[model samples]
Target: MPDIKKAGNIPTSMLAVASLLLSAPSFAEVYVAPFGGYSFGASEFNIKSSGVGNLASDEEGELKVSESAQYGVMLGFTTTDPGDIYLLYSHQSTELRTGNNFSPSPITDLDLDYLHLGGSLYFPKGDVKPYVTASVGLTSMRPSGEYANETRFSMGFGVGVAYQVAPSFSVFADARGYATFISSDSTLFCNGGDCLWSISSDIMWQGQVNLGLKLTF
Candidate 1:
């Protein structure tokens, strides 16, 4: 006859798999959210047009980026603590204008993109939840007219609320800020004779507001 306790014991591997399954879907989930927004905070800087990679040139003019539409998507994995970790990607198409903000000026089209790994913490109250989030990532700056592309380290933070209408769906709106780190005097957007800008600031900032729908499963 076999020992009763030994015979009744489950295999360790079997127990492990069982624990994982029970702790998984019930305690965690994955979600996808798509958002549309307007990004403001058009940053203005001094561009040294005659420098040609020279940072000390005094011949400079004010340049400004125009505010424009932003669109993005997030892929997130929820935690047991009513929050989630997400990867975010967003883009904006705008223009770099020379001279005053309201004047008709020479325009150079530009594209800005951000990629971040981020997380959120939530305050759940009934069907509504409020959350705060933060992230660190990279920003890619692409300028037209023979300028070279530049990539810089960046950070973002935001606060928002979401309303759940079903077990796997919700809608949310949020406001966020993005700060990009730059070398104060590097030839970031210049490409030779036509090159005009060595970034004048050590940091650049922008603000955005978004509205979106989330699907969780």
Candidate 2:
């Protein structure tokens, strides 16, 4: 009779602990993310050393999203708390205008297919968790035509925050910029390997915007 109610509370606490232990495995999370946004950056077209005539000195172009932007979907699996890795399949395209120096002409468009392997680190905070992620993998670009088909290495890193809404779902936004380099031996349209008149450039860089949803198991 001294503490009948107090004795019952002890069993209640034990039951709560057992429930959490049972649910732990089911709480392991997996996320499939799809995102789309705009991309903007600059490119320099160098005149190949063996060119017949010099068109311009490393033509400066303005990056636009006319038909260009970084958008795609990715899948992720958590290997540990505050740590996870993702496989990303993304498409990025850009329109560059030869602003001045060069004569006005049709716009040159650049598009790329990226296959990325990367991981992220999450910082445990209050309601919002911030993370930094980096990826490195393969990328392909089809500048204007098929003859310029090129393959190269690509990589990117960014930091962003996500707010927890439900136990199984969270929304996130990130800003990332990436670059890749490919070598060209054919000057099909190029006066030389390093010439601007050449349909293709010796190097390329892209900046991307990422926004998407994350679902957790």
Among these predicted structures, which one has the highest TM-score? 1
Residue-level lDDT tens digits of model 1 in 63-147: 7668999999987778877788777899999887766322356467999999888899999999899999999888988988777
TM-scores for all predictions: 0.80, 0.67
User: In candidate 1, how many Å is residue 4 off?
Assistant: 46
Poorly placed runs, candidate 2 (over 4 Å): 1-28, 49-67, 183-203
- Poorest lDDT segment (10 consecutive residues) of candidate 1: 13-22
Candidate topping lDDT: 1
Count the clashes in each prediction. Answer: 0, 6
Q: Runs in model 1 with CA error above 4 Å?
A: 1-26, 51-58, 100-106, 192-194
| Residue 210 error, candidate 1, Å | 0.2
